[model samples]
Target: MHRATFMELCDLLSPALKRKDTKMRGALTVEKQVAIALWKLAMPDSYRSVGNQFGVCKSTVGAAVLQVANAIIDQLLSRVVTFGNVQTIVDGFTALAFPNCDGMIHGTHIPILAPEHRGDQYVNHKGYFSMVLQALVDLKGHFTDISVGWPGKMHDTHIFRNSGLFEQLQEGTYFPDQKITVGDVEIPTVILRDPAYPLMPWLMKPYACTLDSSKEQFSYRLSKCRMVVECAFGRLKARWRNLLS
Candidate 1:
């Protein structure tokens, strides 16, 4: 269960969440409850089922989910999710993928129930398709940014633009340079659906890799850096499958 890792996480949270008030110090630790809740969410058992297993009320379980999810995402990702010395923009997907290569993006569906959803927005796409949207993630698969919920029927590019990802890019909040495509796409780069869309300069094509003479010679070149994202996605999906019921 990674006791050391869990304690380290709790220790990091302590400064902000732990209080001096002796009176506030209770019989149990909030961090423990939060960790349990996180496990439940990642695996999403029934609320009543979790309540029984955790020996706590459903309300407490829900609170724990929120508290722990936010804490881990903020703290762990802030420290653990950063890129190491790699050219931040050029090597980073978000820094590379916007307004370029038709802003190539990938979508994945998380398994969740309809009853757990807030509305169609969570599962909302025309035809009530699975919750899916274009996403830009680093080679490490940390979500650098994502487009909001769009109907599955919607074109991936349309979803990219509508999700305000494009607007944010225009404002330089995402990609500073507007000419790089962070990913490979199913279509040709020269084609353009919108007249306003500008063709990008750097187009990446990892999937359609060439068996060129040089590639085989440079087998150990450690090139095709984008494979990191694919590897990351494989691990994430594997974990998700293990956890989700």
Candidate 2:
């Protein structure tokens, strides 16, 4: 982003925090650090290269990278940020374009370096090890309600149970007074998933499975509507390769 945009974000966030006194540093500019972070994100540069050109420590460069990235995320990205009826929460979200479709929930495997991690956290679903990052992204693929980061070895179902999304819903909090749930199985609330799994409430499914063309027409339509979330997810992954990697 341009310096003006960064400055704008800083301006927006500045109102939320108490002011601090600091010289920033010597001849090296804070803007330069910000620029470095941007460049790293735009084009995944090594921390050493970023630090070398930006005239800062590698650690500082990494910190700057995360700070600037998160700031950009916080500033530029938002929920129901895409096109659609944001009031309706769908099961899977591809992007903001179809908010009426709700959102999509999927597990993302992120490679990490936590040597001491063990048990389910340490288990690897695939041959390579990674961390599971599940997110409830809106139509625009931006996480709206929940995002859980855990080790890759964990079961998707177990992760879901532990994610606190269910627990959060059980508490009847409010993103407002209403919440919509969509999944492959049944659940125990006003909102629920499809496919009708056992021991769950609000199970939304096709009701009857048929290959004769007219079976589960509503389900087919819902799936068609939900494809927007899939597209949104594709765009999101493409935009943030580092996130999925």
Candidate 3:
């Protein structure tokens, strides 16, 4: 991150990360705490390695990582990850030839160390320990909504059904209850999904079998537009190299 951006983050996290020095030792500054956490997240390094570089013990590094992470989620997550200006998002997707589309929904597996308890639950279809990160990617390739840390053994359809986004969409509370008529079909604002997901009024998926030219064209357009989410995932893992493993 740029220096200005990092400083701004420190300011935002100060309320939660600020600490007082005790008699035993001087407290770590909020900047140092955030740095430690970011380092751990950006690098595939061990707690001992991070502690050595930061001039602290492994326990301190671990504590700082957890504290800073919790602070970011509690203080910054809602502000950054949000469904902003729904109409604008719809307009953006409309320009891309998918009318009344809100966003693209997809799930990616994030590799993780197997937990001691119920480790098998984290083993995915690929037979590896992982967690699921299901995200809603907007037209501009930003994450509007994310459901992280679901067990990898679970399917994308299951994760989406259980998500808060699913509830809102199902109740007609997520996007405006507006419809656009395409021929005889009146389509509501919907997010594009893969064939693994079940079809819904607010969610669309490619046809299992393209029996005609029209169905093939529809599936082609949906697949082409849905590439945004795949690119977003690539960028995420690229920037956060720790997730590559």
Candidate 4:
């Protein structure tokens, strides 16, 4: 991460991460704690190795990591990742030839070590222990919404249907009450997904059966828009190499 970005994160997390220094020892500054957590996340280093670099023990490194993670989620997550400026997002997608599109939804598997309890549930179709991270990405490849920690064995469609996003979309409350006319029909803002997902009034998916010229053209356009989410996941895993493992 860039130094400026790292400092900004530290500033945001300071309130959550700050601890009172006791008589026995001085509390680690928020900067050091953030650094400890970032190192552990960005690199595949062990906790003992990370602690050695920071002149702390493995336990301290583990605590710092958990503390920083919780702080980020509490102080920064909702503010940074959200649906913002609905019209702007719609315009961006329109420029890409997908009219009335708000975003793209997709799910990816995050491999993990098998847990002691119910580890079988984490075994995905690939026969590996993992979890799922379902995300909605805007045209600019920013995550507008995300749902994580679902067992990897769960179908992507099942995960999406159970998400709060699904509930909001189903109730017609997630997007603004704006509509545009395409031919003789009017359509509200919609999100694009893969064929694995069920088609809904608010969601668009590519055609899977025999396709005519018009259907093929529609599917091609939808696939192009869906690439934004694919690229977003690619960039995320690339930057946080630990996620790949």
For model 2, residues 46-157, the per-residue Cα lDDT tens digits are: 7898788877789888877766666555755553243234454443432322222344455666555545646446558665567676655554445555454677777666
Q: How many residue pairs clash in each candidate?
A: 2, 21, 0, 0
Give each model a TM-score: 0.59, 0.60, 0.90, 0.88
Q: Rank by lDDT, highest first.
A: 4, 3, 2, 1
Ranking by TM-score: 3, 4, 2, 1
Judged by lDDT against the true structure, how good is candidate 3? 0.91
lDDT of 4 by residue, 1-245 (tens): 67998899889999998889999999999999999998887666889999999999999999999999899889989997988889999999999899999999999988787889999999999999999999999999999999999998999999999999999999999998999999999999999999999989899999999999999999999999999999999988786664435
Which candidate tops lDDT? 4
RMSD of each: 8.3, 6.7, 2.2, 2.5
- Candidate 1 structure quality by residue, lDDT tens digits, 35-74: 7666686764876788888787778778777676676666
Residues 150-182, candidate 3, lDDT per residue (tens digit)? 999998888998999999988899888889999
Model 1: weakest 10-residue lDDT segment is 188-197
The C-alpha lDDT values of all candidates are 0.51, 0.54, 0.91, 0.92
Q: Candidate 4 regions off by >4 Å?
A: 242-245
Model 2 regions lying over 4 Å from their true place: 2-7, 13-30, 42-44, 66-102, 110-124, 128-130, 137-143, 174-199, 202-215, 241-245
lDDT of 2: 0.54
RMSD of model 4 against the true structure? 2.5
Off by over 4 Å in 3: 242-245
